[model samples]
Target chain A: MPTHRIDLSIAGLRLALETEAPPADLGVDERYGAFLADGDGEPDIRVVCRFGEPVAPEGKPDYTAEDIWSMYAGADGSWTAVITYPSPDDAPRPPALLSIDAKWRNAVLTEKRSPGLWQSVITAGAAELLIRTRLVLHDSLVMHGAALQVGDAAVILTGHSGAGKSTQAMLWQEAVGARPLCDDRAAIRADAGRRLVYGTPWAGTAGIAVNACAPLAAIIVLEQHTENELTPLTAAEALPMLLARSFLPYWDAALVGAAMGAALNILQGVPVYRLRCLPEAAAAEMVCARLGLR
Target chain B: MIRKDGFVVRDVGGSAVIVPTGARVLDLNGLVVLNDTGRLVWDALSAERSEDELVQCLTDRYDVSPDQARADVDELLQQFADLGIIQYAGQPI
Candidate 1:
């Protein structure tokens, strides 16, 4: 079988992909465009993708099977993730697995199962899970939100689904000429005295992914409102809201502390705000003006 | 009988939050919040202390009477048990 060497450089971390099939065969292009990189010296993380779907088990569970799922844990210093899928009969089955070294620098994709678009799906799934695990170790985290660069500062808008985070990201582009870093997920890292936000290739339906980054200036929790309003969030209120919006390492018992420690560092370093506004140009203008971005 | 693994208390800024990890991540519904009193109780239970020991800790740490400390400990432990954060010894689990 033919294979392709795909290199992805998001922020400064690298992912070397050795796929049995080209990711292009599964339509992975522009979304991963910003992350395209030359296969440099030894990628930080290696993903060896093999072709195949995971096999489902043949029987139902002894007690209940309504909530079949995956989990990750850190034993001693090693990290492993077990991903179990739901079955129609709700039968229990063996799970696909992934593991990382004690240093959180290396990981192996032990198993993957995709019906057809195996390359793109498996690559994205593995990258998302593994990258998240690694990022938390270094005082950084990823969130289900939109990030935009207004002038020199990185502003993030995030909330639960239906909160118009993407809409506001688009609005900022149209109204203030702010560049969209990512309209789906943004990676925030706390390094030295600076908090930085970077774009990822995994754009939610919005299809906005820029591999750019900027100093994280403020965090905005999106709240739909009739009029534009930007309220402040003290550290007390900001910590929980940020955690609620972040991609936490809930499975890695050891990494939970890591993620929390990073979140606290972020909360202390940057100011968080709650943005309540309409999904319109005026709302974007108002937010920019409030932040002195205009 | 509380799990020696799967759960932990993390400090986000100065606030303490309880998060599940490892196998417990399969049951990721939400996290637990700890106030000062709850933190005291949690610290006491960290080493698998019995109910009587927990009641004593609360009484010694705070000005509450033994009876009140026992009542409060029961309330919090019951919540932890219900949330699968801890379990009673010899219980079916």
Candidate 2:
């Protein structure tokens, strides 16, 4: 097959993906279709995908996340990540090796040619790792939250797993006719003069992924409670929660600093609230009424 | 004792907060919020200060006596050591 090129734009971050195999044969995940963009202008991030065994970086890795992946520092200020899945089939070799420059601008994704290598790398996680790490450098990071459009602005509900993010989204859709952008992960970016919330392809179990962007209006951290309560949070209270929920590049200090700065900027511009409520439509109604979204 | 690298401390809304970066994040997953006194101690740890020096820093600034300062410093240093935030001499890296 001839070299195939596909461009994708997510949360205003454009990527030029050049693949060695045909686009169809590469088995790229279907969720990325909504993010396909015209191959125009200079891409912010470039990825060259090919099939081969990557040369492992020498010495002990700077950081290792168990057996899933290991990060090695390069002498020239670049970083290489060897991603291996914790499965019997993938145990023999790493599925993908992603190497990005210190600035995370250019990358080469070398994937092992195996039955499920592409899925593990692209769909399971490696792509998210690439986008999130690159995004931090550009004043953006992916958050584990549900984002929806509510009357011209986006409202993001964030919390850890089993914190009822999806439940609240569904209730909002039913009560206030809100449109769900992304149910699991939302790309929060500091664009121009305002903060914007974007729909990412990496949705959670809800599988709600829409290619959309909206100016962020509010961020609600959910907590399970019998009665509905909404309280505004100060910057100090909100920053830690936002940082905990964000997909920050932990392997690099500079990237972590960038991410923390972005989170602080968002907190300053957007109102953050702690929403303690039950899993019912009334909870959504209360929020919309209190926040004037209705 | 020397403060570990890869930890970024910041002031948010008049309170000090510490978050791990780089390899430190592998050990600490979340942010560590500190009170006013905790912030002072953490700042003093930026240099290689001995326990006596840290106690003197507290006693000189605060109204606490030397004996009281020593006990407070010991508690704070124990907490920091438990969290792997500070490395004492002879402690293996």
Candidate 3:
């Protein structure tokens, strides 16, 4: 069968998805429309999709995630990721499997059944895991945060779930008409001596994702409060908080080390703040005023 | 004794921070900051070393007396044990 390939440029990384199925049959979600790339370039990561009975790795898994995903360390120093979906019908089926080599440059994704393009490509979490793991090698990471383009720069607001990341973004959009780059995951990397944040397709609940990037102005760690307050945090003080909110590849020690290095680089370049604020426009106004955006 | 599989120590903003990797992230959810002496002991534990050897490592590098080094090593090792950062071999090395 002829190989059908779709290339994507996400967060400045090129990913090529090759499958035996025809391109039209690949049910890629519309959310990925903005990230499609020209196929003339060399991809940083390439994932080949096929239909088969996915095999589990030998021995006990090295790591398990939320009872559905598992990671196994291969004897050749590679890693394999298996993602199982919860079926409402209580029927057992083959899980999705993705095996990447030591460098994570190439991968093979296998499934017993083809649900759709999005399910095989994105929903399986195989491509995302590869993207995140490969990102650390290039000194980049994805943080669980929302970012907005406020006057030619990106301001990232990060926190744990339900810490008002989206609420604050809504306030900023309402107050200053700031365009949200992404409402859930923000990809940050250094480019030409300037720290930049890019939007990813997985935009969480706000359902906003833009294929754009802006120089990072600052990073604000959000906390809910009755009144608006912003406090400066040193890089050392901010490292742990940022790491906690990042989608780190915790299954591998070398990847984690690279991620830590990338995070440290970001900390050294960008200023960090802790914002204790209410869910209102006034809080947004204070942040804009303090940042000299208004 | 050997250091845990995924606990890595790095220098962040002039401070030594110990970060966990792999499954260790579940056990230690936060970073561990180490003082100069604590870092010295941690580096010494890269190879299997006894508590006495760790004390000797500190005393050799710093101007502290043997008794003070031993006390510091004891405290540091206890903290490492409590945090599961180090594993013992049952027999003293």
Ranking by lDDT: 2, 3, 1
Question: Which residue pairs does candidate 2 place in steric collision?
Answer: none
**Best candidate per TM-score, number?**
2
* Candidate with better DockQ, 1 vs 2: 2
- TM-score, predicted candidate 3 vs. hidden true structure: 0.89
lDDT by residue (B2-55, candidate 2, tens digit) is 788888876788778788976787667677888777888899988899999999
Top candidate, metric DockQ: 2
What is candidate 1's lDDT per residue for A155-199, written digit by digit as tens? 988987888877788788999998988888899987678999999
- Clash-forming residue pairs, model 1: A251-B22
- DockQ score for model 2, please? 0.71
Instruction: Count the clashes in each prediction.
Output: 1, 0, 1
TM-scores for all predictions? 0.81, 0.93, 0.89
- Runs off by more than 4 Å, candidate 1: A1-4, A19-31, A51-99, A110-122, A278-282, B1-4, B12-14, B26-28, B48-52, B65-71
TM-score of the A chain in candidate 1: the value is 0.81
> Considering only chain B, what TM-score does candidate 2 achieve?
0.91
Per-residue lDDT of candidate 3, residues A1-294 (tens digit):
427888888899999888887554554545477888888899999888888888787777887777778899988889888888653344564688898999999898887754432345344356668887788888999998898998888799998778899888988999988889999889998798778999988878888889999999889999998888999998778888888788887788788788889989998889899999999999888888888874
lDDT of 1: 0.72
Question: Sorted on TM-score, highest at the top, how do the candidates line up?
Answer: 2, 3, 1
Docking class of 3: medium
Higher-TM-score candidate among 1 and 2? 2
